[model samples]
Target: MKKLIWLVFACMLALPGYSQESATRGTANNVRQPNVIVVPYAKEGQDVRQLIENNPLVSRAVSKVKEEFGNRGFTTKDFVTLLKASKRNDIISATTGAKSDPVKDVVLESKADISVEVKIFVNKHANGSSEVSLELQAAEAISGESFANASYTSDKFITQDSLKLAERALGKVNDDFFTQLQNGFNEMMEKGRNLNVRIELGPNSGIDPYTEMKTGNDLETELQDWLSNNSYGGNYDINSSDMVIDISMKVPIYDQVSGKPYNVTKVRGPLISFLKGLLTSEEHEPKTKASSGQQIWIVIQ
Candidate 1:
């Protein structure tokens, strides 16, 4: 009887451990891993394409970081391929009289969830030894909010192979750096991604805050209702005046219907459609301006 009781007690103890292990596996499977892109850092007045093309060290460091991300099961995008495609689009936009922002265009086109900028520096000592330092900065692609950074300097070595030196420096902080980045992305997924929107009344616009819409609500109330319905979990902050409405809202990281990552373009279309419904005359229309990072601007005229 004592042996039987001991066996039952042992079974009870093992149950909790098994349950915990199952729960951990479930969480790991549920977490969505963000796609990442690594690019060489460019200073003011310096082009990123030029930097990557002319500097072998920068190119090598970028490749190393991208490979590390891939090894960790994260999907990585190629910056050079995206940059080349963006340049082709820029020429078409230039002829059409459309404005171009290269950095924003590349990031938006790539559709990478995170953009990492890499910078490398090397110093030579009189004793013929050289030390290499690498810096990595990561940000949410659409929001431009920085989430992770790492800076490491390698021990002095007689070999001048910058790639080897960079690998040594990166190896020291790889675990911690990736941990921070994944944590940041997980938090963003839970809380929803952020977007900033501004609505302005252009000159001669036929509507005002107090105007009654076809839905029997005032213009301001209609706009508020639209935002409340569209934002994720109805979460948003708004600042409004007679002529302008500025909103900072949280939207789902992925579209519920499509199960695909959301971008500014997806959000812009629906908003323009809603604004168009408020227009009572052909003379006034909803005009959408270009998006700047995470911010979108619309003028009703």
Candidate 2:
């Protein structure tokens, strides 16, 4: 039996044009128009503003990448437009800085499916040849998990136009990113998407997260159980304090109760209902926001 199993596995691996992966939930036939957001920076540790404002090369690089994504059928967002539209400066700061909090806030609000951060360095040698070095990383907006990374350098300087150079360099990296993106999306669908949950008690609410529940379990334990059971693989994180419970975890793409995949519009109702019953509080209101991808705020009174 062991030998037969091994033989089967080998044959499976050898099968031509066959794959074990499946499309992400809610995406049919591996065709989904994911919202793609592209942000360009000058280099590692440099603020994106430096590129967005000071460098023409960076602008060209960003535009090229955006165009490439558009050509590939992705619904792309204008990052510059987003920054300008956001009243919250923190989101803008986080986009250009190393701080992730603001980024998460923006992602949550925008609900983008894929976020791409690109860093470019363009050098013109004395021989009149230009070298464009690119470091590109693509992450799932919901989970903040990196799905693709590419570092490529343009060796042949076919054009003196920095814009053209930037475009060509990004093309190389984009190819690699798209190649890995499909598989990564499939894996994320299988594992589920991450959600950031914050639970708080109203000013007069008697609920205490650290207190014991009627089921012989503490509030934290009970909450954990509920979150885990609702999740795809019983996976979750809980940061419980005296007054608050913060949870970050993966929830199933499909809700067992509805037998349908979850999305921005459909997710909140089930979550709010489940949470209200679980807490058994007198008055509860849940707010679902798309930050980092999707965040839920539950307040009990």
Candidate 3:
């Protein structure tokens, strides 16, 4: 038994331990069905505190996340390999110094649904057991908005190597993390998909910004009504100058009628249809902005 205990200690020293932290979100629906990408990381100047991305501990932790989320129907993408090939690996070199330009650019270019930024740390105990911890944040690829965050420690009281320790740690809080992710996604849906809208009136367009519609409502009022009826919490921003109207809002990402996910073109489908009918001149279809999820620019001809 002495030899066995010594062996466990040796194993613990050779492998970094992992831990789990509490989650900060709740549950929701149809919001977390996005492709997942896990990015391993360490702190800016605290690289010694945690293993680097290439470390076995980091890789194992990434695997654990993939496995857990995968079992729940989320498709996992190998973002680390891509980052290496593109020399963007440095983007996640450390947690603090994460270079947004390359990392965000790569993320947007890949068109991934979500990015899981992960940092892991381990502490060895004198009692033949080790503690492994994980810090994770889930963000939308397009807007880089974090939807959920959690810190967790392993449930297994006695663990040896970093791989086993990390796996067991993640297992302990896997369900809670999943719930947090779903809740965040649902919240984003409730707040509306982030979008940029532009409405330009043609030189010959008959309707004036201040003119009243046949419904006894002015152009602004009609537009407002159309937007409110179709958006989350009826939220949006509008600015006008000359014949141009620019509106920015969080548009719904799911169809209330069909209960289906909304792509960029479909995000404002109802609103566009309504405006087209109201404005006889012409209205161009909504165009999605680059690196912006569901962000659209619309023009009135």
Candidate 4:
């Protein structure tokens, strides 16, 4: 008995899935899925603690980000961790959900820095010679790291006066940042991932598996269906680029009297049902609450 138990334990340790697992980041509860983080950018060593306490735009953006991301499998604590860990300049390096460091073949930067510039002339004296051009810029209460080291400048003038100009610039930057962030996330979707597939036919027994046909002029619809079914990732004309496999099959039996092989007979059991219903059993009927052994019926007079 002890020897059998030892054998079972050894089998578990030797199995690849049981012993080794792929690494994924950002998942809390030690579960499967990716995580998201939001960071802010503020002036270097700028006194903005009181500003956060008072500002509304900053608070609104933070709240929306939390609400939106949390609904997409993110937690406040996870977002905070991501905010703390993620670099302000690297919003596109997101690794959350089913993939880890899933960003392959491309790089993304989701951070936006709204920089507004106010250019104005100040006259210290009535004389025309006493003129000075001043440029001032500011960012509102932002906690995300994307704001840090942001490379942006505005040529639009907020106003002619220095104080008013600076204020206008700040407003423009905040508005631009918010708009950019919203648009960036709204259009976000994962790219079509690739899955390798191959079909090999065993020697046909009763089904003969001998008849074959070739497809000519494969069009857009054909290519799309093939790619979708086979999990192909590349995009091109089916007629020009990726095409389906052309098969040739020979008839199995020969006519005894004619001394020639017989024409192929095709089976019509919906092979092109084509490995369907993989994602769900929607094509299949759901289980009904029927008793296996008995049936009840009422008779009316």
Residue by residue across 1-301, what tens digits does model 4's lDDT show?
A: 9999999999986764354321111111122222233333233332233323454434333444445445554433322233335543223233333232211101112221222222233445434223333332322111111222212222344334444433333333334543443333222211111111222222221111122213322223442455444321232122222222222111112222342322221111121233222212333321222211111111101
Question: TM-score for all predictions?
Answer: 0.74, 0.61, 0.52, 0.21
Worst 10 residues of 4 by lDDT: 292-301
Q: Which candidate model has the greater TM-score, 2 or 4?
A: 2
Candidate 1 C-alpha lDDT tens digits along 111-130:
89899888899989999999
Which has the greatest TM-score? 1
Question: Residue 252's C-alpha lDDT in candidate 2?
Answer: 53
Q: In model 4, what lDDT does residue 11 have?
A: 94
Q: Summing lDDT over every window of 10 consecutive residues in candidate 2, give the lowest-scoring window.
A: 21-30
lDDT of 1: 0.78
The predicted structure with the larger TM-score, 2 or 3, is 2
Cα lDDT, all candidates:
0.78, 0.66, 0.64, 0.28
Off by over 4 Å in 4: 1-31, 34-39, 78-301
Highest lDDT: give the candidate number. Answer: 1
Model 2 stretches astray by more than 4 angstroms: 1-35, 42-54, 70-112, 123-131, 155-168, 201-207, 252-293
